[model samples]
Target: MASSALQVFGFTLGVLAWVGMIGTCASPEWRKNSHGQTLIDNTLKYEGLWVSCTAFVTGQTNCKDYAEFFVNLPQVLQICRALMISSIGTGFVAIIITVLGMKCVGLGSSNHIVKARIALLGGLLFGISGVLTGAAVSYYAQGVLQDYYNPSFAQGLTNVP
Candidate 1:
């Protein structure tokens, strides 16, 4: 009984994580620029993998999508985008595998050991998806920080929102 309960809980959490990954990939505000802005400026700049946006104090927002060509983007952005997309795909596959292997679903083999191994494989895929997400976010953040702190870099041009 306890094992069944644990499996349900794990499945719930895994599904939640997969949904969160999808949301993250679709969100357009991964990084924001609000430093040293006065009320007069009244503009907030933010960007994500696919779009850049500016929010005005007047409650207006304008966004622009990235270049159409994949090869035209910067190396860091290209890598981050690839990683996030891959993470989402992997998470989706993991969810399907996990559901099939779940005790309550029992879609295939009835043997406990086989089902357990399948579940384990799904869990590993989830782990890999998480790692990909982390790597992408961390790498992008590192680039943002480097640009933010660089003396030679133009502050006004950092966030293209």
Candidate 2:
């Protein structure tokens, strides 16, 4: 079960890498236009999250560091979660921006932006679903990390009681 979970998380991490690369690979010329600019910005934003994730999974750094800085307070953790969630949103924005940019180029007539929109929307949906599922698996892995630093605390009520 745990292996399966880790696989899911790893898969998520891979998708994030792909998104980051796509965003990076997008043309700089696209940035000249406002619409294209938005897509590039959003894509890079998601890229940042994936970069962070890569660092964490590699044991170089982890979100827990940020979470700890906030003392894991709801207020601070909220910010952390927001960052993670926004990564998903950023991916969607990239897709939308890319599709819109494509449409602006006159990719097709009649169908026009419809197909572009649909393609981007579909990609976003798939990306988001992957991120959501990955988050669940990653959350479980957190226990192993917590145990390493403070075994007693993670063991159960003994840490608090």
lDDT of each: 0.83, 0.41
Model 2: per-residue Cα lDDT over 15-119, one tens digit each:
575476345333122111112344333222111212222122223533212224334343423443454455556555644444443433344333644654544
Worst 10 contiguous positions by lDDT, candidate 2 = 45-54
Residue lDDT tens for model 1, 23-123:
88778878887646688456888888889888988889999998654687878878988999999999999988987777778597898888888888888
Winning candidate number (TM-score)? 1
Error of 1 at 114 (Å): 0.5
Candidates' TM-scores? Answer: 0.89, 0.28
